[model samples]
Target: MAVNLQKGQKISLEKEAGGALSRVTMGLGWDVAKSGGFFGFGAKSQAVDLDASVVMFDESNRPVDVVWFRQLKSRDGSITHTGDNRTGAGDGDDEQIVVDLRTVPESVRSLVFTVNSFTGQNFSTVQNAFCRLFDTSNGKEIARYDLSVQGSHTAQIMAKLYRHNGEWKMHAIGENGSGRTFDDLMPLIVPHL
Candidate 1:
């Protein structure tokens, strides 16, 4: 049973999973919108190269590590990105970031998940976009955030997972920005940290 998360909503991962979570996964998915088609006729869908990234931050809100398409794993080997999906053509998750919760460094106080269009395509050309969290061991979905807000921004700071009283929790950020990569969006993401 997964909760459809609203923007700014927060949830306790431990309570949602019925116990401590050993490993978790953040899955990002989306689809390209079709254009130049008659009513219900043949329309050509544009290719959207969206990248999912996890930025690990310390108590001081300083980014300590990041796992993305280029950097597939964190320095400590606790987090790993599945791969990149150039075209959001298939169903389910287009990209996945797996986190071994137990192995995540104690110094890391928060993990921010983000998505950006590497090809500079804005959200207006994307549809059915979503970010979801689940237990990697059993594949039980815990929470899902719909990234369906269409706009001209090329990136979205989707959600955050932070430690609270020795437990992990989730917060849906749903902030939009104009950037083609994580480095370009760092300024916009710092305020949320």
Candidate 2:
């Protein structure tokens, strides 16, 4: 079952129902640049610095491992080195992060994504951020969340996983700011885990 997510929502997964074989996949998406321009026309283009990551945590919310991390660019969704921006500047663009839960420790109960920088001088205003969970067993989407509610800012976006009764649950959070490190994101996400 694919979880349909809206902005400012959260879900959790329970182990009692799915057992150890349960796997979850999370995806983040956003429009990097706007057609009108960055903060409007005649302004410096902002490039998404594109630092994406997934941190696995146990029930206790302790750091487990980094499941996936990358800096992305306009590559037609291909996983290759398109490039990186020291400053957040550019036209409208799309960037994403993909995480496969199977590779991480089974104890992991949640995942979080943080934007390190908008590198390009113009692209710093993030339009959207989101995460989704997929059922690896059937290759179906279990749940999804859209984080576009917090428009035009840099911050940490988080998704939580835990079991409620016998089903998995997830929670989506959008933290706003720039220069905030990944470590700063943990506290906002830990409560949901």
Candidate 3:
């Protein structure tokens, strides 16, 4: 069964399966809202070039690696980005990051998921935005967090997957921010990390 996560909610990766979640994938999806043009005329909805990324941080919160459009795979081969999605017109995941949890280096303690509008289109024009975690082995959705809240922000700090006392857990953040890329979101992300 899939769990709908509320902001700040944290859940174990193992669920009731009695075994560790060895491989998981984070999926992000969104669509641009059709806008009524000037003077109440219909204008074609613009495509939102939203990008999903993961930043790996060490124990002290120092960034160790990043998996994004430009860098599809982590140096150690634990994290891999499927590919870039120019348009969010698909039925399923528009962007996905797969992680071999057990293969992650011991030095890397946490992973942060972020989504940004590279075209600078604010969330107010985006609809049906969501982030989800799935067990790759079974293709079962483990947890999902809605990122479709109405706001003027251009990006969001979606969630965090981290190691806690020998177990992997996920925390829903759903915090909005103004950023076109991960670099622009660093300041806002620091306070939360």
Candidate 4:
């Protein structure tokens, strides 16, 4: 079972499953909103090339690595992006980033998951946007953060997974922002890291 998390809510990964998770996946999904048409039959919905990105930060809150469409894997090879999904036409997990929890560098204390519209469309043009965390071993969903809030912002700081006292926890952020890529979201994400 998965918990629908509210903004600012936190949950310990180990406590949620009664054991430590060796592998986890952060999945992001969304859909293109349709423009008006007769009876909503042939309405044209613009194809949005929204991107899912993960930024790794050290204890000092400095960015250490990133995984996205361009850079599909972190330098250390612990984090890997499945691939780029240019269209939101899929059923589930339009983009996925797999993390080997045990292999992640000890220096990297936190991982921030983010989404941005690479084609300039804002969240108002998107629907059913979501970010979810899953335990890879059992394929069980642990938590979900829905980015269903419509707005003019082009980006979102979806969630963050960080280590505290040797335990891993996840936090839902769900903040609307304006950016086309990870680099552009750095300023808005810094304060949150």
C-alpha lDDT values of all predictions: 0.94, 0.49, 0.90, 0.92
Error of 1 at 52 (Å): 0.2
Candidate ranking under lDDT, highest first, comes to 1, 4, 3, 2
Task: Evaluate model 4: give its TM-score.
Answer: 0.97
Which structure among the candidates has the greatest lDDT? 1
lDDT of 2 by residue, 63-181 (tens): 76653334342122212222333433333223334444344344556555555553522223555544555554655566666555544455555555544454455665555544444
In candidate 3, what are the lDDT values of residues 6-35, reduced to their tens digit? 999999889632467889999999988878
Model 1, residue pairs in steric clash: none
For model 2, give the 10-residue run with minimal summed lDDT: 73-82
What TM-score against the true fold does each predicted structure earn?
Answer: 0.98, 0.59, 0.94, 0.97
Q: Model 2, stretches more than 4 Å misplaced? A: 1-3, 12-23, 35-44, 68-104, 118-124, 135-139, 150-152, 163-167, 177-180
Tens-place lDDT digits, model 4, residues 92-156: 98999999999999999999999999999888989998999999899899999899799899999
Please report the TM-score between candidate 1 and the true structure. 0.98
Backbone collision count in every prediction? 0, 45, 0, 0
Residue 60 alpha-carbon offset, candidate 3, angstroms: 1.1
